[model samples]
Target: MRIGINLLNLSQDRFGGVEQYITNLIGHMADSGENLTLFLFLKRKLKNVFPQHEKIKTIRFRKVMDSADVYDAIKKCKLDLWFCPLHRSYLPSVPVPTVATIHDVLHTEYPDFVPGGLEENNRYYGQYTASFDAVITVSDFSKSTIARQLSIPEKKIHVIPLNAPAIFDQAPAKITMKGVKQKYQLPDSYAIYPSSYNPHKNHLNLLKAILILREKYNTTIPLVLTGYADKSNGVYQSVLQFIRERSLEKQVWVLGYVPPEEMPSLYWNSSFLVFPSLYEGFGIPLVEAFKTKTPIVCSNKGSIPEITDHAALYFNPENPKEIALKMMELLNPLTRKQLSEKSSLRSRHFSWKKTASETLKVFRSVTRN
Candidate 1:
């Protein structure tokens, strides 16, 4: 089958879970000998992950002022199936089959999370609902949300859990401790919070928890913040303000954007990983933490409990005291070791090779008349 993977969202992103999913899927599909032709689109930031795929046919569409330019490109390609790995609400301009992955509906869960979020979220949801041949989601919770919000049948969506890179499940690099430590400028026994500065990530509460931890522990294990700060959203700015207001400039380090290769090392050097996201379809960072032997302190909200599955400590996202208490436990050597052990065990449940094989099965099942 001539499967066309939409490189639209993957093209534009600066390395996140969904982008990694697309890149991994396409790479694995190429190796699987499937006739998968990626409709490769380029954005300014995306590195060439599809360079070696002979089966992948790339079409570059300029970032036109009108969305119709993108529409015209897809229709003109005349693909038998369009696989959109990164979620967007692009309607099909042609009758050929289109499959999309909807990771989450965050704005619906926390409308106040970002500016103009609800309207855009609803607009995207309305446009893409039932238009695809099949929809893919990371968790059952998200499937129901999509079904209820979009008014699409639950059966119409496929549940494919997100996968981690082999690097995460692989052995940690034997780089010098000082090298990695100096790279992130991290002190001993610090915690990690790997996420964009989006509000639904609920980082403000993390700062509050950090303050609580500081008052209790009286140590400097900074909470490292990675990912792009969307100035338009004000989430990152609010976090900065909160830090300054509390004289936590030294306690919270905003490492604007870390390259992908450096991430696993950061995960290894940290004492533990904390994800206080208010909502998520699937917590990819938690899985990464698991794979890298990093203990976790994640929020009990959204699909975090489902995703982590009792592998890590959970706290109410809104409860700063509870979050701080979890961090305290995280800092304790024995408890951290136990959580890290459990993380290793839980990490086994996910893999990119398995995800790729499953995704291919879906393709065969759908395309076979």
Candidate 2:
């Protein structure tokens, strides 16, 4: 079967979840010999590394394609279906079946989390949920919420849990901790929180939890925060203010937008990982932590429990005191090792191969329809 994909947003330097999903899925499908021909649609000049297969050919669109041109490509290419990995314009130009992945409903449910999202993103949520043929969500939480929000049939929405790529299962890089420390200027004995300052990630709560441990108790271990931070968001502003108010500028290391390559070491070298998201369709960091054999202190919200099981020390995401208590539990050696072993045990349940096999089933069913 021939498949056309919207790869315009793809990049090799992605620190976001959608980019990882697209890049790894294409690579795995290419290597799996599914007898599928892929035609990619991209508009940007970003660096791309698609699989080299006779079956796969990239069709780069010009800076813009008119409505007529988009339809022309759809019919002219004779694509069996068009797959938009991220949310694309919900209205498809051609009659071919359309499938799109909706990672999180945060933008719809919690508009405060996004920049002008309360006013701007509703149309996207409305379009994709109503217009798409089949909706693929990253978790059951999203499937249920999106179904209600869009008033779409539950059967039309499918829940496909995400998986860590082979990179997570691979051995650590040759770089030493000393080198990573110098490269990122990271300190020894630090706790790592790799999520961004996005409000839904509950960065404000995490910051408050860390401050409780440091300021209230004078715990000296530094907290390493790796994510993009813009001051406009309430969470970002609060985090910045907390650091200044508590005089925690030195205790907090905010490495805004670290590259994807260094993520593994950052997870492994950390004393423990903290992911107290107020909301997540699927917390990608929990799986990454489990794969890296890193201990996690994650929130009980969303699919964290479904994914992490008993592997993590759960905390109430809203109460900063609760997150602090969980964080304190990690400092105990007995609890630390227990969580470490359980994390690795739970991680074995998820894999890209498994994800691809299941996803391909959905693709096959959709094409037949």
Candidate 3:
């Protein structure tokens, strides 16, 4: 089977989840020993992102390749299937069956976070998805949302869960952890939230919960945040403003965009994971915590509950008090130990190899039709 993967939408370290998803999926697929020939279509600058494999071929284009160029490339590949791992493809029409992974319908579900609101969300996510032969999503929640919001049949949208990056599985050496701790100026004991500064990530409410912990409970829980933060992002700016206004400078440490290699150390050293996001198609950090045997205290919203299942202590994301209470609960040694055990056990349920195998099934099924 010949499969073409569209990786043009990704840039190095920019798209956290989608980028991880594609790279992991391809890695597993190439190593799966299946009778498959994979063609990767990406910008020339990103050619080195995926390692060389006998089953994989790279088709690079200039950074400025437009829609026509993309379409022409797909046509020339003459693939049995074309897989767009992120939402939609640039090609208007392709020579082969198409499958797209629409991670979430967050734009339509929460237009407030999206710029230009519903009109813009619809323009990007609404009509374009319908053109694909099949849609892939990370969770049942996302599958349903994509179906209802986009008016695509539920049967057409496949639910394939995601796993944490393989890097999280290996325990970081004590010396390495010491180095990461010193490099980031990490607290001796702190909660970690690894998410980009998107409004839907709800960093503001998490900060409020931290403040509540200090004022109401008289408990000061240090927090270490990891993900992209930039001056240009209004949401990140708002998070900074909230931290300043609440005097949470001491309690909160923003270690923006920690490298993938250093993440395991952060997880190993953290007291527990705190995820107060308002939305997620699939919470990768939850699994990361599970893989590291780190307890989780997270929001009971979107696909979070589905992904985390009983491994985490759930709290309403909109209620800072509830979030604070959960955080407080997780601080107990017994509670943390118990959840950590569950976290370890639950980590067994997901793997990149499984994701790749199921995805290959999707490719074969689509191509057969």
Best by TM-score: 3
Ranking by lDDT: 3, 1, 2
Q: Candidate 1: where is the Cα deviation over 4 Å? A: 9-13, 41-49, 63-78, 216-220, 230-233
Tens-place lDDT digits, model 2, residues 249-315: 8888888787666778888888899888878888778889889888988889877777788888899
Q: lDDT tens digits, residues 88-128, model 1?
A: 63554545677778888787878887456788778766776
lDDT of each: 0.77, 0.76, 0.87
Off by over 4 Å in 3: 13-15, 63-66, 123-126
For each candidate, give its TM-score against the true structure: 0.90, 0.91, 0.96
**Superposition error at 237 for model 2 (Å):** 5.1
For model 2, the superposed segments whose C-alpha errors exceed 4 Å read 9-14, 115-123, 128-130, 173-175, 230-238
| Every candidate's CA RMSD | 2.6, 2.4, 1.6
Q: List the residue pairs that clash in candidate 1.
A: none
lDDT of 3 at 206: 89
lDDT of 3 at 170: 81
